[model samples]
Target: MIKAYSISLGALLLGLVLSLVFGSDLAFQRQWQLISGVEPEQFIDFAYLYSLLPRMTMALMVGASLGLVGSLMQQLTQNPLLSPLTMGTSSGAWLALVMLNLWVPLDIADLSAAAAMIGAMFAMFLVIAIVGIRNLSGLPVVLAGMAVNIVLGAVATAIILLNEQFASNLFIWGAGDLEQNDWFWPLWLAPRLLPAILIFLLAPRVLSLLKLGQQGAAARGLNVVPMFLLLSVVGVWLVAASITAVGVISFVGLISPNIARRVGARTTSNELWLSCIIGALLLVFTDLLANALSEQIGDVVHSGIAAALVGAPILIVLCQRQLRAQDQLSLSLPQSRLRWRNRYYGLAAFIIALIALLSLLGQHNAGSWSLAIPDAFNWLLRWPRWLTAVSAGAALAVAGCVLQRLSF
Candidate 1:
């Protein structure tokens, strides 16, 4: 435990120093006199120093809060699948932004964070309702999240189609850019998050108790319902704030905890601290990559892709043959009741309908709609959007059903 704490503390301090050094260097480089012989303290002018200080503080607090939330979420859901993005909160936040844009026409630059928070909370509410207190699990929440995400994504797409002027801006934001001017974001997040962090710290044993099955927790005299709800609210708030500030960076919550566990943090407290360190390092490193690579690759490569880069290989390893074998032996699986009656015929009909739509609406932006239909159809099966959506939905549904059966 001491070793873990020391490692985490070391990483945290190191990240802070690097953040300050890099941030100051960038500010200095922007000016020629500072490049030559200006004092380092001159680079840290009142305005520059203030801006740098607040943003750095924001990053640390936000990262730590996000890490804590991820830890609690993984433990509560008992699945590594749950995360702010995967669980649909980020989509919900985007949906809110779309609605705000359509309805209010207020300055998005001013209201982005507020809109994000409301949207994230709304998404969390939907997930909680679908999973219910009795049926709560990582998988059901993920399915509900994906459904919300798809519907919201479709809506956002429609908005973009109608308002082409905003398309580029929305696209940029959607891809998870953490660059912001607000020195107040950390201040906004810190006060709200600090109470929960304190509660978590004081009740370390409670987290371990909660990690046990509901029955085990109850047997230990824990108030499972209220405590669970409280933790979820804190987790959601932490995620919402981070997403609001950083945009929808996928897999930070999902991958950080797993990495923490892999590094020898087994118990809840250890995992929580390690996750904070890992999450901070991840965001800093990814932000570095974003700054360094943006000139080469253009702005299309986002910080969120860092999670995929880091997490994808780890996910495969986590699902290796040995793990599968252990799961097969130790777990008695539930039979799946898939509703497959006229689905395939319906699917074929839909494909034909899509073809017809393409025939009618072809040639909007580019090539002949008629020619594009076949290409699109052929490509549809291989399309990342379609394939990921369907696979994620089906897998989450089955997993949810299985978990509900086993837990019940």
Candidate 2:
């Protein structure tokens, strides 16, 4: 516990320093100089440092909250593959927001978050229902997540088709930008977080027993079903609150717990605390990078999309390696199962042709179902979306099939 606490403090301190050095203050030096009417601090300065507090506080709190939730979730589900993102809470929240704005004709601008929270809970319920029915394991969890993600994604696409403005904002938000427009952080997160932390801290004995297995925990007089439900609700809350604040930051939950495991933080208690620290550090650093580079690139670049671009690939590699390791333990599984195979090639081709035809067929106007294909780069910019979708869908399907075969 001491060691974990020390590590947490150390990481937080380091992240704080790094965040100060590289975040918005550094990125927008000209603006700061214009505002402060003085030379900017190289590493730390009192003038602009006060401004960093809110952003830093939001990042740390959200990161720690996500980390703890991730650890608790992994412990309860007994599946490292499971996280709030994969479980469909974030996507569900986005979908809920889309629905509220689309069908209800209500201005959810002030209250969009409430809609997201409710949606996240429902999404959590759906995931839990799917996984619970299958008796729970790595494969079931991953498959269920994939299914939920697909469904939610389609719903989001449908919503976007209806309202392009909402779609545009939703897309950026869906990619998970942590920038705050107001003091919404403390208002939304603080109330639930304190009590959740207390509950988790007090329930360590039960959590430890849970690591043995559900039946093992139950044998020890812990009510597995009720506890699972409670943890699921808390997990959903943490995820919803964070997403509400930051707009769907991906991989914090997965990466934090994995790093904790790698660092030999084997106990659930240690894992939980360590995961929080690591998660905080990871996000603060990522945000720093976002601020630094995106500022340089200007209007053409997007920080949220950039983080997803980098983080998604890293996650893919890590997950693949882990899957490979799992496959190795059961040597009888065919090596063919590990190979990359595309399943949606044919479907993707058809979709691409259809879109191309529509693009060609549609009249060039202000707005219509016909997408205005640029005359200059018609082949270049237009074809990639369909091709990319097909390629990704095919690859995922093949991977799933392989994993299922190996697991069987």
For candidate 2, lDDT tens digit of each residue in 128-238? 788674344454566577689779978887778778964567677666766654455656677757646754565567678877777788888998778777777767777
What is the model-wide C-alpha lDDT for candidate 1?
Answer: 0.67
Candidate 1 off by > 4 Å = 20-55, 107-118, 128-147, 198-203, 298-301, 319-408
Model 1 Cα shift for residue 195 (angstroms): 3.7
Output the worst ten-in-a-row residue range by lDDT, candidate 1.
321-330
Q: Name the 10 consecutive residues with the lowest summed lDDT in model 2.
A: 324-333
Query: Which portions of model 2 show Cα errors greater than 4 Å?
Result: 1-8, 24-51, 103-114, 131-134, 300-306, 324-408
State candidate 1's TM-score: 0.69
- Clash numbers, per candidate: 1, 1
Measured against the true structure, the TM-scores of the candidates, in listed sequence, are: 0.69, 0.72
